[model samples]
Target: MTEQPDSVVNDPNNYKLSYRKLILPVSLISAGAISFAIPPMKELDLSAKIEVAHDRPGKTTLDNYTQYFPAVMVYGLNLAGIKGKHGFKDRTIIYATSQLISAAIVTPAKSLIAEERPDGSNKKSFPSGHAATAFSTAHFMYREYRDNNLLLSLSGYPFAAFTGVYRVLNNKHWMTDVVAGAGVGILSTELAYWLYPKMNTLISGKKKNNKSVVVPYYQSKGVGMSYLLVF
Candidate 1:
């Protein structure tokens, strides 16, 4: 049988790719590459930016909060007894890995490409990190719930879509930037899914680590995380 993305394999020897699962990430990446390489598509990207700018829609900070809705839903649903594919630790690790991978890819690319934002804010705009984060979490939610509830699994996409669209609408990114970010995000999650089993094996094989407590602190305008090491 083909290995499912949500399958928990504690053995690194069982690590394998499921080609069927590659469709979404591959198609997105291909589309992104085409958008970057093809003249007509590049024109489309510019036209899209211009058209949206012309609309003069009032920019809102909604995207900031909504981008993480899918990931939040994953945990919320699981907590409410709508069990997902993996248990708490496994799902958390997978989600964290996906976020890490997406950040690692997007951060360096932003520095290297230095594409300016539509609003002329800065040059860290080749790929929309917000869109990338949205799609990565959306894909993570989908992978966890796809087999059981297809509709519910897909519910996160509209939010993800909105996040990407708003990145352009808010003049924070170009259409092509959002497209590339979506591709990168999905690819990140895909890689996380593939690597998680191997990672789990390695982690499980190790001796228990020292205990620690993570405390979340709310500050003036942001949240802070601190850890207490236990000997």
Candidate 2:
């Protein structure tokens, strides 16, 4: 963790829940929900769909892959020696947990809502799964690196936003669906962060005192990692 300068040090206060941070994501969810009832908001969704359908940009599979880029950046940055707030094991587990949570939320909504895709492809388009996963990973990246560099932390959002926009451009989801998915994704990631410590404790049972770091090396023959055990 010392490798990441300017990060918040582990402290009791850091564990205290901050409701203030909940405002934006919660508002996003509420707005998406309210869009269903409000005529103007509902019309806005329809207008967005029509516009995309009329002039859909070059349909690329970039959205499918870009969703995971932010999370990948975290690991790549770590390997490049710009560590974030957590170790590889910790960050990976948290991100995986976020994925599970986002899936849990998005999957059921897709089934129950039965909203057809803009392309009439299927009845699973109320919330975009890709958008949810994209934002979840983006938020994961943001949370890990926010204290280190604000710009670096925010770098994930462009990818997330692109994922959401392309879902519409590809006629995969409606505007409101993307917005709601983003809300769910952000909430899921936040929950994972809150739950990580408890989950780690439950699994470990005992505080881990041993210290070790794994360093990967590139060589002519083969690539391997060196495990350094520190007393």
Local accuracy by lDDT, each model: 0.75, 0.75
**Which numbered prediction scores highest in TM-score against the true structure?**
2
* Cα RMSD, each candidate: 6.2, 7.9
- Model 2 clash count equals 0
lDDT by residue (tens digit), candidate 2, 64-155: 88887898898789878988888755665577677777777777777787887878878888777788778888998999889999899999
What TM value does model 2 have? 0.82
Summed backbone clashes in each candidate are 0, 0
Q: For model 1, where is the 10-residue window of minimal lDDT?
A: 213-222
Off by over 4 Å in 2: 1-12, 205-231
TM-score of each: 0.81, 0.82
Residue pairs with colliding backbones in model 1 are none
Candidate 2 C-alpha error for residue 198, in Å: 0.6
